[model samples]
Target: MVAGRLSRYFGRRFLGASLTVFVGVFGLVLLVDYIELMRRSAGEANASALLAAGISVTRVPQIMERIMPFAVLVGAMLCYLNLSRRLELVVARSAGMSAWQFVAPAVIAALLVGVIATAVYNPIAATLQEQSKRLEDRAFNNAAQSGLQATGTGFWVRQRSVDGQSIINAASSTDQGVRLGGVTVFMYDLAGRFVERIEAKAAVLEEGYWRLVEARRYPVDAPPEKLADHQLKTNLTLAQVRETFATPETVSFWDLPFFIEMADHAGLAAAGYRLQYQKLISRPALLAAMVLVAAAFSLRFFRFGGVQKMVLSGIVAGFLLYVLSKVTEDLSKAELMHPAAAAWLPVFIGVLTGLVPLLYLEDG
Candidate 1:
């Protein structure tokens, strides 16, 4: 009964700390986003505060996505610091509880946050991101230039074709970005007349050429009746196709597989999507690692001189972990690293490094 009570107490403590951290961090993010929006609107003939506020609110989800790790760090720090300040940790230790036992609630909380983040927050963020793009289009009057809009219909991209001109509309892409689907390849000659149109059910981006499938070819000089289905040959490669469909963040974890398959069918490179897929599977471990990293810093609160120093150290550690994770992601996208390794390496390193302090403070 006493153990149950202790668990509940710790759980409540951790929950309160996490909530406080989230609110504080979110407020700061809102301020920064609002300021940036204001700066961008300056010197414009007219500005809409209401529009800016709505856009800023929409931007919150994206900012929150980036802020979650820091939130974990700060929240964990607060939980530990509070316990240490009240000597609750010492009392727990005296009662035969180890550092690990004291940290268990926080760790569980972090895991819950991770699950929620993957299943709920990420999808919401994806939606907000798409909305943000629409809002930007409304602001600029150029829907075509709007970037990274998420959709269940699959990823879409518009780009200029090679030879320095012409627009290509690709409804979907695959193979890390080497194939395209529902492709409409349009070209205009120097005379400003539509010179050619190539519509393909799919296009494969090979080494130096795009091989169109179920294609229809149209020549401006030819009679409409003369237009015929023909396999196409073009100089665009898989890499170039990938460049057009590059924002992997707009797709949710649950939707990545379908997107990847669509890309594969369209003959585009799916490497980035593939990497993101592997990363999502490893998220539980990553969450556990964040908890462990936090515990490592906070475990020494009794021995450390000041709570501020511990908090500072935790922030620095979190930043380094973030940087390492980004580097690994880049490596994975470039195909220079294994997808699993790139996704999990930071977590592995953080957990392993964190273990030393945990063991010393708790087990020893």
Candidate 2:
């Protein structure tokens, strides 16, 4: 009964600390993002404070998802350190409780938190992220742009049809690239000769063609003609269009499997999505490993001294883990490593890094 109570107490402390840190970080990110948005929209007449705030509120969740692991690490460390200072850990240790025994609750809690973050929080963030994009577009009048937007470099697609080939560009796109804004299409013949150019305000992918709206056709040898609507032949499908704009971060964890399968069926590379799915799968283990890391650094008896040094080491170790994850992520994105390997290598290394020290401290 006492042991169970201790476990609950430790779990509650860890969760409380983590929640406090997470909220602090969220507010900081929201404030910084709002200020940046405000600065960017300073000269725009259509931009409003409410729009910027809404965008920041929606976007901060995705950013927070990335920060969750760090919060767990810091919170766990603080929880352990505080317990050590209060002699709670000392009493627990004196009661024949092993460090692992006391730490198990926190580890379990962290794993549950990771699962919740990946399953529930991710979908909400993805939906909000999409909304944030729409609000940003509305605030900046991005749909009315005459050329490619400065951010993201927009999207480009190439199509070859029986008639000829065309290179399509858009300043902005939505609905997974099914709809495009500030569109331009350049046509060329089989012999690579310049054919014509079509500039449109918008384009939508249809059953068998691209429906361009408010378009101007400039023929190679004749005068430009304005057309209210024009249909351009194409052979691209919805899957291909989705591949062009569905970045991995913007995709929900629950939907990643379907996307991966679609990309596979379409013979398109889905490395980013594959990596993201694997990352979410490994999140629980990664967060559990972080608990071990925190325990390793913060479990020293309060009277043993060197507490500051241990705290610094913990911070440095956490930063190194973040850097390692990023390095492996880049390698995965570049296709230099398999997505599963890239997603799990850092996690494996983290577990080892934390477990080795704890094993030494506890058993040796």
Candidate 3:
């Protein structure tokens, strides 16, 4: 019963501390976002434009969501540091609580925050990012061609043939860019002659060859009824197919598998999508690591007198860890590093590195 009471008490305290930290951080983000919007609006010639810009500025939270790990680190560090500064940590230790016991609540809180970020914040961020991009494009590029649009069933794309003159309107694509669904390839000679027409249910990209599925070929002089089901060949490769689709970020996590398979069928590399997939799976571990790292940096306040030094050290350590993660991600994407290694190595190293400082200050 005593242990339960103590745990509840600690939980409440940690919760309050975390809430305080989040508010402070979120306020700072809002302030910066507002200031940026103001600066951008200064050059605008009209009130309506400024209003639209202001509305777009609210999307900063989505950008900031990407930095949630940093926020968790800073917030958890502040929570522990504040507790230590108020002598609450000392009192808890005097009451027979170990350093680990005092830290357990904050660690758990950070993990919870991480889970919320992954499941909730990420999708919201993705949506807001798309909105922001669309706003910017409409504002700046009135004549720019929009990318392919997707529905629940398929996506549309436009690509140029190898001759770099003919435009292909592929109504939908599959097999990672290798296969075209509901395809209509319009062939025009240099003189814009109605040379030929090809219709196919699917088009599969192979090395220097495209295998058309249930295809019908028509020559300029041939009647439409004379066309027969036949395979059409092309010089397009898997790389060309994916190039027409653009980045994987436009697709949501739920849609990655389908795209990955499409890429595989096209004989193109799906390394970027693969990395994102692995990273998504490692979300829980990454969040747990952030909490541990935060604990390691801030849990020393009881013994350390140099607040500025510790804060700077924590910031530097966090920055280095983030950089390391990016480098590992790049290497993994390049196929030079194992997917598992690229995804989890930084987390493992961060946890171990964090534990060393925590142990030295709290236990030793």
Candidate 4:
């Protein structure tokens, strides 16, 4: 009963501190982004305060999502620091509860945070970002009257074949990015001559190529040829197509499976979505590891005379973790490593590194 009570107490404290940090960080992001957006809109006649606020609100969530791990780290640190200052942790240790035992609640809290972030917060952020984009388009152009169009929605891609270099413009695409609409492909010859342009009503990625429907080929100095079906030879895979437009952040965890299925059907690579899904699933574990890391630094006695130093060290360690994570993600995207391994390695390293030191400190 005592153990359970202590765990609950610490968990509540950690959660409260985490919430405080969450609000503070988001509030700061909102203030900064709103001010910047408002300033940038100074010369635009249509830009208004409300629209700027909307963009800031939409953008802040995703920015907050990126900082969540750091929040957990700092929140847990604050929780432990406050307890240490009060000698609560010392008393708990004296009473036979190890640091790890007392930190269990914080671990659980971080796990819950991770779950909510993945399932609930992500979708909300994605929707808000899309709405923000639409608002920008309407404010700058006459899109509201004609309806918002998808002309510049996704990334543009270029591919080379013996036939020529092909520049692809897809007005819109599914999250899987294999199915495209309003696609225009401009083909050029090796000597930089215009060969022909193929405009397709829609395109579906097929194995090693693209299957275009309702395609029209417009040759230079010739009449356009209408074709019921067209095939464009592509060295690009489904995975490559997916990367060209749908960044991992834009796709939600719940929708990743659907995207995977679509890519699989198209015989394209779904590595990006697969990696993102794995990362989302691994988030709870990663946050739990963060708590352990924070605890390892903050559980020392208040009289140790280096509390600030310890805090600084913890901050540096967190920074290193973030930098290494970015490096690994780039490597995974470049196919230098398996996506699953890239996604989980940092979390694995964090847990082990944090746990080992704490275990030694407490048990030794």
Candidate 5:
């Protein structure tokens, strides 16, 4: 009965502190992002303050997800420190509860939070992130004349059919590349000889074909021909295009496996998707490790000296973990490291780093 009551009490304290920290960080991030978006959209006629705020609201979730580990670390530290300061931990210790015994509740809570964040919060954040991009694109639609110039030069796809081969380029695209603007296509013969060029105001991906709008076709041996609409043959699908255009962060954790398979079928690299999936898989363990780290730094009684140094050390440890994760992510994206290794290496290191000091402090 006593153990159960203590566990409940500790869990409540840890969760309350974590929630407070999470909300505080979320609000600050939202405010800063809103201001930045407002400033960027100042010259955009369609971008209002409300629209900017909406975009920021959508974008902040993904940002929060990225920094969640830090929040957990800080919150755990605060919780433990407060308990120690109030002599609650000292009393618990006097009652024969080990540091691990009290810290176990927080670790379990952190694990549950990580699982929920990965399985539930991630999907919602991804959907909102996609919506945020769409809103930003629409608001800035007229900011640049060249659709390509406006949207970071767009994308290119090569398709082949019985008629021969074609290279398609677009200045901008939407609906996961289903609709394209400022479109250009270069045609080649079976002999790989340049044959024709087509410029279109827009192109829509259709069943085994491209529906080009307001198109002008230039032939190598004949005069250029204009057509209001043209049907070009190709071999591509909606899934392939969508997978091509979707970023790693915009795909939900649940959808990542399907996306990775689709990319494989489309002959595209799915390293990013694989990395994301692995990261999500390791998130629970990572959060639990953060609790250990916090306990290591904050479990010292208030009467102990070097409290400030310990707090600073906890902050620095959290920052180093963040940096390490980013470095490994980049290495994974560049194909220099395996996705699983990149995703789990930091977690492994963090766990060990937290466990060493903890074992010494508790056992020695």
Candidate 6:
């Protein structure tokens, strides 16, 4: 199936169509997101349109990557529908060729495209996304010094040790919990009774403890005491803090293994990275599945008047698949299901849903 003049021709057609659709969709996404960003920042000071545009563009690759399966679906639909319209498929069918035979090239092409996207394009997207976040912090977050942000609350982290339990909060923090501003600490004894409240203008993560500056401590039964400096013991490390808010997409496929290991060692949740790793490895199969879905909707000619409806149905199905994946991811992140099961189950279901229909229609 991978070799022959006809196979080459079909492969070229499929690859060309998919690439064109990917480019077009990426551009459309960039324009829409850029405009949205600008609209949101309309009243904000120092919001550069060019910077916003650049951030939007950088985000396009990642968004495009997510929708690549949909592109494959549309591309295959377009390619096959055109062939049917031009009577190419009719000729092939008359020559004793079957749908499965011709669809092989497109399936192969989709597999290759998925592999390249996961391996190469993903890393670049992640880097640019990180850059976009930095730009956002500078533009609106005052370089991330403002803690708890617009929501009127801050992030919370916890520590439990022989000393008792403590909850930490900051208005904003660095990637690592190394530095924080507008910090507060609440400590409780082994029995969960309140022991003290500590407030600080700033906090820095030092070896074995947190170093607080401009600190005031209020004991449970005593008045507030001002202090120049204070130390609180901590088991959390810099890596754990850095990984806390790090979403799966920020880590590349190649780096995910190491990231997961480090995150687990640092006592951070590693399920997100594990789930992303599973998804990355399953991309090729998912794209091929999309090709099958396209074929299921594409074999009819436009002259029959129902082709448009089928195409719409196919596109809607692709969107549903994306939505399903997101839902499963949330469930996995919440620990309701095993990470491997959550990531792979959706892909498997999507592939089977497409493949089974193609098998019955093509050969049955």
What lDDT tens digits, residue by residue, belong to model 6 across residues 128-207?
76666556655564433532242357767888868899998777654334666678999999999999999998788877
Ranking of all predicted structures according to TM-score, beginning with the best and ending with the worst: 2, 5, 6, 4, 1, 3
Clashing pairs in 6: 147-171, 147-172, 148-171
Query: Which has the better TM-score: candidate 1, or candidate 6?
Result: 6
> Comparing 1 and 5 by lDDT, which wins?
5
lDDT of each: 0.69, 0.87, 0.63, 0.79, 0.86, 0.78
Error of 5 at 220 (Å): 5.2
Distance from true location, Cα of 58 in model 1, Å: 1.2
| Model 2's TM-score against the true structure | 0.92
TM-score of each: 0.74, 0.92, 0.67, 0.77, 0.89, 0.78
Off by over 4 Å in 6: 1-3, 94-96, 141-154, 159-167, 171-236, 266-268, 303-305
Candidate 5's C-alpha runs over 4 A off are 142-153, 171-174, 196-203, 211-232
TM-score of 5: 0.89
User: Which pairs of residues clash in candidate 5, taking residues 3 or more apart in a chain or in different chains?
Assistant: none
Q: What's the residue-level lDDT of 261 in candidate 2?
A: 91
Error of 3 at 126 (Å): 1.2
Runs of candidate 2 with Cα error greater than 4 angstroms are 143-153, 160-162, 189-193, 206-214
Off by over 4 Å in 1: 43-47, 142-246, 301-309
lDDT per residue for candidate 3 within 181-250, as digits (tens), equals 5666666665666677777765667666566666676768976633334444455556556645545554
Error of 3 at 360 (Å): 3.4
Clash count list over all predictions: 18, 0, 3, 2, 0, 3
Candidate 1: residue 4 lDDT (0-100)? 58
Residues 1-364, candidate 1: write the lDDT tens digits: 6655776788788878878988888888888887887787665444466666677787788778767777777787778778887888777767777777777877787778788888888878877766765565455433333444335544554443444334566665433345455667776654556778877666666554566666676777774332234434445444445445656776777877777887788787677888877777767667677777887887665655775776677778888989999999899878899888888898888788678778886657
Ranking by lDDT: 2, 5, 4, 6, 1, 3
| Residue-level lDDT tens digits of model 4 in 150-218 | 344543678877677888877655434676666788888889888889988767889978898889999
lDDT of 5 at 227: 98
